[model samples]
Target: MDSLNIEPTEFTPRINFDPENNLFEISGFSRPENVIGFFRPILKWLDEYSDSVLSRNIDFNKSLLTVNLRMTYFNSASSKFILDILLEFMKYHSRGNEILINWYYEEGDDEIQESGEEISDMLGYPFDFIPY
Candidate 1:
């Protein structure tokens, strides 16, 4: 029942780390002054969680990791930090663990859809885009 749930604030993104269910979610805007400082802990959490899960889940016959993202927009500076997060998750995917990332965007957002495509191309991470 390990979880790290952080509420959304004016300067930070919301984080819901539910390892027991293998359901992690990150949403809200991210234009913080120090993006590195904000996301560093989340990245660290993921790393440690990876180690713990690998040790306990020998067969991995349980739930899989599902990252649900619904970011409206992000600043140019935050892009790199977010990129790191995606890459970390991709590692789990590469290891044969089921990884599902859902990218939700508002309707009629061609730019966002195209950006999603760019991300899929850049990271080679398969994402299911859902229009809202």
Candidate 2:
């Protein structure tokens, strides 16, 4: 499947989901006007991918997934949706998948740091923080 790339917008975060190497990245500020609509296709795609993996007997758990999150800021509404996206990957973790989240934050960015920590705490797999 072709990757999804959404440009930076006043309300939406830039998205770069690459399936070739299973590397997905979402960065920039996010406070989308229509949160669910903005994320529906992405969530749908992941759902289909999961189904495909199971039906084809494709061990996607063996595939490496590197997720990069370098958001400068996000509203609380966006935060909830982002967690939904992350949970998709978390599902694979239970199936023996190798996934890593390289979460970067600005120095002294307490909000971002705390946000990352909360997700990391909730994640099924371990995630590392990379402060810049």
Candidate 3:
């Protein structure tokens, strides 16, 4: 599957999805005026990628999928969308895919760390929280 790269804007985060390298990253701030519009394509891409992987009979056990989330800030609406994205990854992982989620937060930022913990707890996924 082709990669999906979206440049970061003042109100949106940068999205980089590279299947070849098995790296998926979303960083920066997210407060898009149209939250749903901003995330629809991303969700679609994940669905397509999941389909592709399933159809190709790929061995996810041998390859790991790494997802990095380094958000400095995000609005409430964006938070919901962010969870949706993570849930997609959770689905992929539930299907016996080897996946790791790395949640990065700035040092001294308790809010971000708590947010990651909350999401991790909700999804029942053990995420690696890296404080920079």
TM-score per candidate, chains pooled: 0.90, 0.90, 0.94
* Per-residue accuracy of model 1 over 1-132 as CA lDDT, tens digit each: 368788877867788989878888888777888888888888998888888884466784645789888877777677777778889888887776788988888899887677777877899877999999
Q: Show how many residue pairs clash in every candidate, following the order shown.
A: 0, 0, 0
Instruction: Give each prediction's root-mean-square deviation over alpha carbons.
Output: 1.7, 1.9, 1.3
Model 3 has an lDDT value of 0.90
lDDT of 2 by residue, 15-70 (tens): 99887778889999998889888888888877876677523546544777789999
Q: Over the stretch 4-80, how does candidate 3's per-residue lDDT look in tens digits?
A: 99999999999999999989999999999999999999999999988986447555454678999999998889888
Candidate 1 Cα RMSD after full superposition onto the native fold (Å): 1.7
> Which candidate gets the maximum lDDT versus the true structure?
3
The residue pairs in collision within model 1 are none
**Looking at candidate 1, what is the lDDT of residue 124?**
81
Candidate 2 lDDT: 0.83
Count of backbone collisions within predicted model 2: 0
Choose the strongest candidate by TM-score.
3
> Which lDDT value does model 3 have at 82?
89
